[model samples]
Target chain A: MPIVDLANPSRFLALTARLMPWLIGATVLAFAVGLVMVKGAPDDYQQGATVKIMFIHVPSAWLAMGIWALMAIATFGTLVWRHPLADVAAKAAAPIGAAFTALCLITGMLWGRPMWGTYWVWDARLTSVLVLFLMYLGVIALWRTVEDPSRAARAAAILTLVGALNLPIIKWSVDWWNTLHQPASVVRLAGPAIHPTILMPLLAMAVAFLLLMVTLHLAAMRNEILRRRVRTLMLMQAQAAPGSAS
Target chain B: MSALAALFVREVRLAVRVGGGGGIGALFFLIVVVLTPFAIGPDLALLARIGPAILWLGALLASLLTLDRLLTADLEDGSLDLILMSDTPLELAVAAKAFAHWITTGLPLVVITPLLGLLLNLDAGASAAVALTLFAGTPALTFIGAIGAALSVTLRRGGLLLAVLVLPLTVPVLIFGVAASNAAIVGPVPFGTPFTILCALTLASLVVGTFAAAAALRQGME
Candidate 1:
């Protein structure tokens, strides 16, 4: 089994309990440090203060891809192992991915306006990210729409895995065709040779984003459990009523 | 065998015969196109600049309006159950439904794009690109929408949910469709890259989406 049976609810709770406070601390601490460093960095010789948005924009972009990939792993777990936690985790991760994607878009637009002289341009990278954002929204929407939980989870899992199709398209969109959004910098075919000053804060921001996502994912999984518990309780209450129909 | 085909045709015919105007889709499309000039400004130059993109966005939205009804009506009336039990595999049935759906909604948009293009002030080349992309892309719309439709097929009042689900999955086609047209309309970029990308996305969706929807339909039946 690729996944050990993880349905033991106490184990999930125990794991999240141990992980949550550390994730919360790491995220808050890193955000504070990263913010200070970004604010203190000397203005770019070329773009100046507006370029500062890159600290936020780039990290969100990294997490947007990272979270989608994480969702794919969860989806694979559900589809192959029929692991119950996998469905909950994938469902839990979507809104966070959507939030990250939206953050990426807003920051991109802010960064673009000064650089491109337009708030929004339909460049390939921007357009592909927008597509990815919509994909996140769609998967979340489908998960909520269905009445049967198991079926919805399976369908949404399938979609999560399938929509991973957009990842490479997004990464390559700038290079694959002409676009205003510049191609990858710290990440490139050549690899990370970016100046250390810029690279260090960027790495810190990535750590912050990862920790934030993990905290939110645990919160969301907790929420799912509560929602299901409530649903089950309501079912029991309805059944208890003398005239209730099953 | 023909009876299965007939049932599929009946679904298509019923949709057309109920015809409230086909206007909701076209009107939604026209309204989106119509609003762009006001919102983006009366610059014919700006409108012309973004025209193909506006058209592609409008077409994708218009196509979505038809999806809520794609599976709901049949599932409600119990016709879907009979189709499930019929000799035709659900995949073929789905492919047929998708074909019929394209005929009703997508085909009209494809036909009317040229007329709409003139209104948007798109030139001859951009209009052709719009037509070509719409032709290639809407079948993907039907197929993708079918899966969303199937997933929500069992629910009452599933329309808004349908939009939320399908819109994201359809984004690639929307991006490439607009890009293909935008390339020719907007600049020095070669058109072939986006055009080929659009074709590949549509073909991929046609295969994967078809199977997913078929599996969903079977699940619904059982």
Candidate 2:
């Protein structure tokens, strides 16, 4: 089928319905394998048992940024091409993205208390991530405030694009201002600083988190399409009723 | 050209006259600055240490307070629709309004910062630095804020929502603004670096915010 067919709500719904179970199953399997790998990994020489938290924290942070990047791409779709399903994808991803960002912050704090000797610090990484979380909330609030779906989508799209442009600047300014959080260890040009014992679990958990995010996004988009359908049906019925003006 | 100039002048005049604009922002800046010394107690050193931050924050919040009125007034009075239908491009029109906003709201806050700096126990040089940064920096706030203003123009009681949407995006401006001031006051690092970055931020926001805000305004119109 042509990719354009996927823009049709019914076609998209049918696709998601068929894909949902497999996605859910894969997500569960990934999580189970990831957790087992995390458990089997030896404690860090420095961080000890608390290093285990890295499995969840790192993946959540990755997903937090990943989801926004996805939304940013969807934003271009909404604004440039006027893709019908693009806004649905963007809106569906927001709350889930916010949740992951919150999780990243909370778990970072939990990790910090034991490792950094404080519940929180105004470290560059921490501060930028907090800003990201706030940005997510703002996007969600913008989504809710606009009653018209198409208008809201375009408005939110513009905001998201502006935000995407700002994200690097935010990260750069924070990095320039101070340094408390350790610099990137994984995903560096020099290669992974972590041992394979730990790296395996982190990779597994990252995959698991990605799967979970995709599953939730698909479900949310399905619901949004259905909600639009219900609204259209209701409007049609109201217009058909006696004495009701179109 | 005359149309754009007229719109800019009209926006500035309305901002000064309207309850949501100039006077309130300056007053709120004063209150925030004045209340800080009492809240932190009379430790002169401490006050001086954080003074630049307090002033930058005051300027930030004050600019935010006046931002909701930027486009909403035009929107409510039906001027926005007329502006949309006009021959001039929407981007230039949005930029004009934001420039006018900086003039009426942001510039006053910059003017008052030196006086507020005295309340924070900052030295003359420190106060001068804060004022200079605010002068260079607050336009970024107003211009960037115009996007939020445009986004929230259709909503009732959108002032708070405007803040939420705009504040995080202003972090770079706030960071470099305060950093530039701090460098001037008490830094081993040279002041020129952050000051230059702050200018770049202002210029970048001028272009980015204008285009984004115009797009949002167009979307909202539909």
Candidate 3:
């Protein structure tokens, strides 16, 4: 089907309904394989067992940032193209993205207690991620507070685009400031720093998380479309009933 | 006067009228500063050390206090619809409103900072440094806050939500503003470095905030 055909809510819903089972199956399969690989992966000579947290922590962090980038693109669709699903995609992505960001922070804190010897520090990486998390909450709150979906979407799109300014700052923060959080290892210009023993599982886990995010986002978008339908039906019913004008 | 200048003047005039919230922000700033010492006790050394941060935090919260009025007042009285229909580009008009808001609400905080600083036991030079940073930085706060104001203008009670939406975006300004003040007060790092970044942030936010706020206002009206 042509891409524009998916612009129809019913068509989009149908597509997601067909795609979800496969997506969920893939996500489960990927996680299973990723976890098994992670179990077999060697313990760090320095970090020891604490290194295992990276399997989850790093992927959540990636998705935390990656989801915002996805929303930014969806926002462009919202403001520029006025694509019907754009705002839905952006709105649906928010709470799920926020969950990943919170997961990233909590797991990082867990990793830090053993590695950095503290639950929290005002280091550049940590601070920027915290700021990212806060922005996610702000976006979600904006979504919840506005009663009108389209207006809320436009406002959120603007805010999301503006918030996108922080992405580069967060990405470059480790280089810009000599913070306690270590710099990029996996996706650096210098290439993968870790041996395949660890790198393979990290990649697998990241794929699994990406698939999971897609599945969850599609499910949320479907529910939102249904909710809007219910709202419209209820409003029409109220208007049709006698003495309901007041 | 030209349309933009006329709009700017009207905004400033409206802000100073009775119950305009022109002075409330500064009053809030003073109260925040005064309450700090009471909470932290009168350790002059400690106050002097952390004075700039408290001052910046006070200014940050104070600027937020009246932001809801930026567009909501015009929106409520139906003047905002007229402004929207006028030939003046919405972006420039929004910028003008934000500039006027800074003059009325933000300027008072900067002017009163040195006095508030004294209560915190901050010395003359330290207070001056903070005031200077505030002078350069608070416009960014107002402009950034404008986006939140415009976003929440239609909501019946948007004050707290506006604060939540705007504060995280203001983090960089807070960081650099405090860093510059600290640099001037006591620093191995030169004052020029972070001070320059703060000014740059203000400049960047001026453009970003204006455009984004304008876009949000236009979208909200529809």
Chain B alone, candidate 3, TM-score of: 0.98
Deviation from native of the Cα of residue B214 in model 1, angstroms: 2.5
Q: Rank the candidates by DockQ, best first.
A: 2, 3, 1
Off by over 4 Å in 3: A170-178, A244-246
lDDT of 3 by residue, A112-171 (tens): 898878999777777778889989999999999999888889989988998998557444
Q: Tell the DockQ for candidate 1.
A: 0.34
Clash counts per candidate, in order, are 0, 0, 0
Report how closely model 3 matches the true complex, as a DockQ value: 0.62
- Cα lDDT tens digits for candidate 2, A23-134: 9999999999999999899999999999999999999999999999999999988999888799999999999999999999999999999999998988898889999999
- Candidate 1 lDDT tens digits, A152-239: 7777876776677645654454345446655567877777866667778778878778778888999899788667778889888989
Task: State which candidate, 2 or 3, has the greater lDDT.
Answer: 2
Task: Give the top-scoring candidate (DockQ).
Answer: 2
- Model 1 agreement with the true structure over B1-222: per-residue lDDT tens digits: 486578667766776775523446777888888887878778777777778888888888898887876777777788888888888887888888788778878888888888888888888888988898899888888888887787677767668777777776776677678778877767566788888888887887788778888876665556
Per-model lDDT: 0.78, 0.91, 0.90
